[model samples]
Target: MQQSKFPKYIFDWFGGLVLLIGYIIGSVIVGFVGVAGKFIFRLDFMQKPWFLMLSNAIVFCLVIAAFDFLIVRPKTGKKLNFNFSPTNFYTYLLIFPMMLGMMFIGEFFTAQIPTTGPFFGDYYEFFENLMSGLTDDPVLMVITAVIMAPIFEEIIFRGIIQKGLMNKGVEPWKAILFSSLLFGLIHGNPWQFVGATLLGGVLGLVYYKTKSLLLPMLLHGFNNLCSTLLVTYTKNESFAQAFKIPEWEILIIGIVLFSLFCYLFMKKNKVHYSDI
Candidate 1:
C-alpha cells in the first residue's frame, strides 16, 4: 500500500478521482465499441440492454486488472490475490437469497426515487428497448448475467477500488460507503442508485471481513441474475399474475431477516473493519 504524502481525506479524493476517471474512460471506450458494432453490423445483439452492460463489465474488469498489475501493484508494492475457497462458496448461500429478496423489496420503492431523465430513466429505457429488440436466449442470458458480471464487477469494484481505498488508510465505513456510492453513481440511476449503494456497502463489508473478492462478486452477480429472472418473469403476463403478491411486505421481511443474519454472521465470524 502506498502511503499518501497528502492528508488522509486527500487520499480518498485523489483515489476517487483516479478511479472515477478510469471508470469513465473505460466505459466510454466500451460504449463506443458497442455502439459502433451495433451500427456497422446492423446487429441488435450489440444493442441488447444487457449485452453492453455485461460487456462493459468484462472490459472494465480487464482494464482494472491490467492497470492494477502494471500501475497500481508496481507503484504500491502490493501483489494481487485472486484466490477462492469453500468458505467463500458458503458465503453465497446467505448472499444470494437475501439479495434476491432485496430486489423484490426494491421494486416497491421504484416510484419513490428518480427513475427518469438523463441518468435514471434514459439509462434503463435504453437497455429495455435494446432487450426488446433482441431474441431471448436463456443460455446467453445466463452466460452474460450470471458469469461475466460476477467475475468482472467484483474485480474492479471489490478488488481494485475498494482495496485501494482500504490501503490508503481510509476507515472501513468510509471506504465502504464511498466505494459503494461510486459504484451506484457510475451506474447512473437515481432510482436504483440507493439500493445499489446499500448493497454495495454490504458487499464491501463482506469483502473487508472475508478478505476475498469472490464473495462480493458472487453476491453482485446473484443480485443481478435475480433481477434478470424477475424481469423475465414479469414480461410474461401469466407468470407475473401467478406470483403477484404484496411485494412490499416481503421486502420488509427480507430487510429484517437480512439484518439479523448479517449481525449473526459478523458476530460469529468475529469480523470487523481492521486495517487491511
Candidate 2:
C-alpha cells in the first residue's frame, strides 16, 4: 500500500465520530417518530417492539448508505462488496466458535475487574429492560438482532470504515485494531466493549482475508442469535453458567476448540489479499 499523506488516526477518529453522531441523530429521529405516532395515530410506537426494531434497522441502514455515498464511493470509486462467496464457507463456519470462545475469554477477564459502582449496576438493569422488550416480540428480535444489526454493522465497520482506512494507506493490523476498538466503543458499555472488541477483531480478520462483507454479517448474525436465545431462555444465568459447567472449564474447552479450528483453518487457507 502506498503511504497516505494524511495521518491514520484521522480516519480512525472520524469513523468513530461519524457513528456516534449517526446514532444520536437516529435516536432523536426515532423519538420524534414516537411522539408523532402517539398523538397522530393514537399508538405508542415506543411501546411496540417491532416498530422499535424497525426504527433501529432504518437508522443503521441510512447511516451506512450515507457513509457509502458521501465518503466511500467518491474516494474509492468502487462499491463495497456484499457478495456471498462459497469459497470459504467452511472456514467461515469456524469463525462462530472462534468468536464465542473469544467472548467467553473476554467475559472471564472482565469479571475480574472491580465493580464501577451504581452506574454499572444501572447499566445492567437498562440492558435487562432492553432485552425484555426484545423478548416480548421474538420475531422482531430475530429480525433486528440476527439480520438487520449484522448487515448494517458489517457494512459500516468492516466495509466502509476498515476498508477505507486501508485504502488510505493504513497498516492492516492498525486498521483492524482501531476498527475493532471503534466497534467495541459503539456498544457503549465496558462489559460489551471487551466482548465486542474481541469479536470485532476476528470479524475484521475474516473480512480482510475474504474481502467479502457477507461472511462477517452471517457470523455476526449467528452470534447475536445465540446470545438472544440464551438471554430469552436462560433468564438469570450467564452463558457459562447455563451449561451447568464451571466457568473455568468452559473457558478451557473454548480455548482448546477455538485453537484447533483456527489451526486447521490457517493450514488450509492462505490469505489472498495483498494489503493484509
Candidate 3:
C-alpha cells in the first residue's frame, strides 16, 4: 500500500465530526417525519411501524449518501465506485464463527456491563417494544433489518469513514478497529455494542482483504438476516419447544474451520490496494 502524506488524526477527527453531524441531521429528519405522520395521518405507527422505521432508514441513508457524494467527495476529490462482486461469498462463511465468538463474549460481559445513559431494565424494554413494532410485518422487518440497514450502514462506515481514515495515513488495522468501535457505539446500547463491534471488526477485515464494500455489506446483511430468523423462530411455540441441540461441539468445529479458511484466504490474496 502506498503511504499517505497527510496526518491521519486530522482525517480521523474530521470523519468523526462528519458522522456526528450526519447522524444529528438524520435523526432530526426522522423526528420530523414521525411527528408529521402522526399529526396528518392520525396514526401512531402501531399500525405500520415497519413503514415508519423503513422511512427513517431510507431518509438517513439518502442524507448520508448525498453528503458523501456532493460535499464530502468534492472536498476529498473522490468518486463513489461501489464494487459489489459476487466472488466474495466464501469470505462470509468464514465470518460466521467470528460473529458467534463475539456473541459468546457478549454473554460473558452481560453481567458485568454497566448500564450507561439508561437503566438496563428500561433499555431492554424500549428495545423490545421497538423490535416488536418492527417485527409486526415480517416482510418489512426483513427488508429493513436485513437488506437496507446493512447496505447503507456498510456504505457509510466501511466505504466512507474507513476509506477516509486510510486516506489520511492511518494504518489499515487501526482504521478498521476504531471504525468498528464507532460502529458499535452508534447503536446506542452497550449490550448490543459488544457483538456489533466484534462483527464490525470482521466486516472491516473483509473490506480490507477484498477491497470491496459489497462483500462486507452482504455479510452484514446475512448476519442481520440470521438474527432476524433466530428471533422469528424463537417466537414460535413449536420451534421454541423443540429439543434445541447444544452447539458447543459445533461451535468448536466452526472455530477450526473458520481459522483454516481465514488462513487460506489471507495467504491466497497478496495484492493490496493503494490508499486513497
Candidate 4:
C-alpha cells in the first residue's frame, strides 16, 4: 500500500464533499440541457425515471473516476486492486449467502428504528419511489445501480479511504471502523445509514481479508440487486410475505443461518490482507 499525503478523514470528508459538489454541478448542467431539449427540441424524456437515474449515475461515475485518477493517484500512487487475489471462488460462494443473512439481520434492526416522524417519512417516500418506478427501467437500472455504483463505491471506500488509512499506520480494525462509519454517513439518512454501515463493515472485512476490491464490489452489486428485486417485485411487504413464510420463523432462520455461516467462514478462511 502506498502511503497517502492525506489522512483517512481527509479522504472521507473532503473527497466526499468534492463528489457532492461535483454532483450538484453536474445536475445543474444536465438540468439546463434537459430544459433546452424540452423547450426547443420538444423532448420530454428528461422527466423519465431512467433518464434521471442514468444522469445521476453517469455524473457520479465521471466525478469519482476523474478525482481518483487525477487527484488521489497523483498523491498516493495507490494501485487500483480491481482483481480478486489471495482468495478464490469458495470464499465468494460463502460470502453471498452470508451477506443475505446479514441483510436479514440488518433489516430486522432497521425495522426497529423509530422512523415515525415527517423527516423519516420523506426518505421513506424516496425509497419507495426508487424501488417502484423512479428508477424502474430494468436495463438502465441494472446498468446504473448494479454496475456503475458498486464499481466506484468500492474503489473509493476500500481502495482509497480504508487502504490509505492502513497505509498511514492505523490499526486494521480502526481503519475499517472509521471507513465504515464514513460510508454510512455518506448515505445521509438513518434508513440507509444503518444498513449501509453494516454492509460497509462486511465489505471492509472482505477487502481487508483479501486485499482486493473486486470481491466487495461483486458483493455490493449483489446486495443492491437483491434490494431492487425485493422492492420492485414484492411491493413493500417484508421478505417473509414474499416467500409465504412466518415472520418469526424467517427471523429465527436468519439468525441461525447467519451464526452458522459466520462461524464456518471465520474458521475456514485465513486472511492475507496486503499481497497487492
Candidate 5:
C-alpha cells in the first residue's frame, strides 16, 4: 500500500460528521417527499420505516458519488474505487456463524445493561416499536432490512468511509476503528452499538483484507434478517428466548462461534481469497 503525503484525508472530520450530514440530508429529502405524497396522493410515507431507509440509501449513494466524482476525482485524480471483488463462495457462506455469534453475544451483554432509566427506557420503547412494525409486513421487512439496508450501509461504511480513509494514508486499524465507531453510532442505541461496532470492525477488516464488499454485505444482511425474524416471531431480539436455551449457554455458544470465526479468518486455506 502506497502512502500519500497528505494528512490521511479528514474530509471535514471524515467519519461521523459525513454520516450525520448524509442522514440529515436524507431526513430532509424524506420529509419533502412525505409532504408531497400527502398533498398529491393523500398518503404520508415519512412515518414509515421502509421509506426512511430508502431515503437514507438514496442519500448515501448521492453523497458518496459526489465525493468520488466531484471532490476526490479532482483532488486525488482517482475514484475511491470501492471494492466489491468476488471471493470464495464457501468462505462467504461461513460468515453466518460469525453473525449469529455476535448476535448471541450482543444480546447477552446488552441484557445486563439497565434499560429502566428515563432515557434508555424510552429509547428501548422507541426501538422496539420501530422493529416491531416489521412483523406486520414480512416482505417489506426482508427487502428493506435484509437486502437494501445491508447493501447501502456497507457501501457507505466499509466501501466509502473506511476505504477512503485508507486511500488517503490512514493506517488500516485506525480506519477500521473510526468507521466502526460511526457505524455503531448510526444505530442510535447503545444496546445495539456494542455489537454493531464490534461487528463493524470485523467487517471493516475483512473489507480491507479481501477487498470484497460481498462478504460483509452478506454477513450484515444475515445479521439483520435474524434480528428481524427474532423480533417478528418472538417479539424480541433475545437469542436465549428464541433458541429456548439458557442465556449462559447461548453466551458460551456465541463465544465458541466467534472464536471459530477468528480461527478460520486467520487460517489460510486453499481458497485463493480465503486469507487474502
Candidate 6:
C-alpha cells in the first residue's frame, strides 16, 4: 500500500470533506457562470438543452478533478483502480437487478411514511423540476445521467473516498457505511436518500471485494438508465397506477426474487479482500 502524505486522522476526515467541498464549490461556479452567460450573451442559458447538459458535465468533471488533485493525489501515490475484467462484467449483470430491487424495496418503505405536509410537497415539486429536464432533452439527459454521472460518482465515492478510508486503516464496514451515508446525503432529498444509501452500500461492497471500480460504475449506470427510461416513457399517473395492482403481492414477489439474486451473487462470486 502507498503511504498517505497526511496523518491518519487528517487523511480520513479529508477524504470525506473533499467531496462535500467540491460539490459546493462546483455548484457555485456553475451558478455564477450561468448568470453571467445569460447577461452577457443575452441568452436564456437554462433553457438551452445543450448548454445545460454541457455545463453540468463540465462542473461534474471539474469537481472530480479537484477531489483527485487536492485529496486523493496528495494521499495515495497511485491512481485509483479503473481496470476491468470479464468477472466484473458478469457480476454487473447479476448485481444491477439486485440493486434495482433493493431500491424498489426502499421506495416501498419510503411511501409508507406520512409527508410533513406542505414542506414535503414543495420538496417533491423541486425534485420533479430537476427531473423535468429529461423530457426536454432526452439525448442530453441520457448522456449525462446514464453515462457521465455513473463514471463521475463512482470515481468519487467508491474509488476515492471509500478506498481512501480503507487505506488509512479504517474497517471495511465503517468505511462502506460512512461513505454510503455520504453518497445518499449528496442526493439532497429524503426520497433519494433512502434508495441511494442502500444502493451505495451494495456498490461499496462490490468495490471492496473486486478491487476494481468498473463494476460499480456499470451498476450505477444501469440503475440510472432504467430510471431515466421509466420516467421518460411513462406518464406519472399511468406509471403509478400501473404498479397499483396487487401492490403488496408484487412487493413480496420482488423481495423474494431479490433475495435469491443476492444469494446467487455471493455463492458464485466469492471474491473477498482481506485488507478490508
* Best candidate (score: lDDT): 5
lDDT of 6 by residue, 122-211 (tens): 788888788777666778878888898888888778877787788778899998998899899989888878778988988897788777
Tens digits of per-residue lDDT, candidate 5, 125-229, equal 888776666667888888888998888889778877887787668899999999999899988888888888888977886677677788889888888888888
Reference-based TM-score, model 5:
0.84
Query: Clashes in each model (backbone N, CA, C under 3 Å)?
Result: 0, 0, 0, 0, 0, 0
The candidate, 4 or 5, that scores higher on lDDT is 5
Q: Please say which candidate is ahead in TM-score: 2 or 6.
A: 2
Which one wins by lDDT: 2 or 4? 2
Clashing pairs in 4: none
User: What global local distance difference test value does model 6 have?
Assistant: 0.71
Error of 3 at 91 (Å): 5.0
Model 3 residue runs over 4 Å out of place are: 1-11, 45-47, 69-71, 88-118, 236-254, 269-276
What are the clashing pairs of model 6? none
lDDT tens digits, residue span 108-194, model 2: 665654454677777877766766887777787788888889988887788778877886798988889988998999887777787
- For model 4 the local lDDT of residue 212 reads 70
- Name the regions of candidate 5 deviating beyond 4 angstroms: 1-20, 48-50, 78-80, 269-276
TM-score of each: 0.73, 0.84, 0.78, 0.80, 0.84, 0.84
lDDT of each: 0.63, 0.73, 0.66, 0.71, 0.74, 0.71
Report clash pairs, candidate 2. Answer: none
Candidate 3 per-residue lDDT over residues 33-123, each given as its tens digit: 7778799998665357665766658566755766565556676465455555545445555555555554444434443565445687688
Q: Is 2 or 5 the stronger prediction by lDDT?
A: 5
- Rank candidates, lDDT, best first: 5, 2, 4, 6, 3, 1
Q: Alpha-carbon error at 61 in model 1, in Å? A: 4.2
* 191 Cα displacement, candidate 4 (Å): 2.5
Better of 3 and 5 by TM-score: 5
Q: Please give, for residues 47-151, the per-residue lDDT of candidate 1 as tens digits.
A: 565665566675666566555555566665665554443363445566565565555455555535654777767876775665553226656666666788678
Error of model 6, residue 55, in angstroms: 2.7
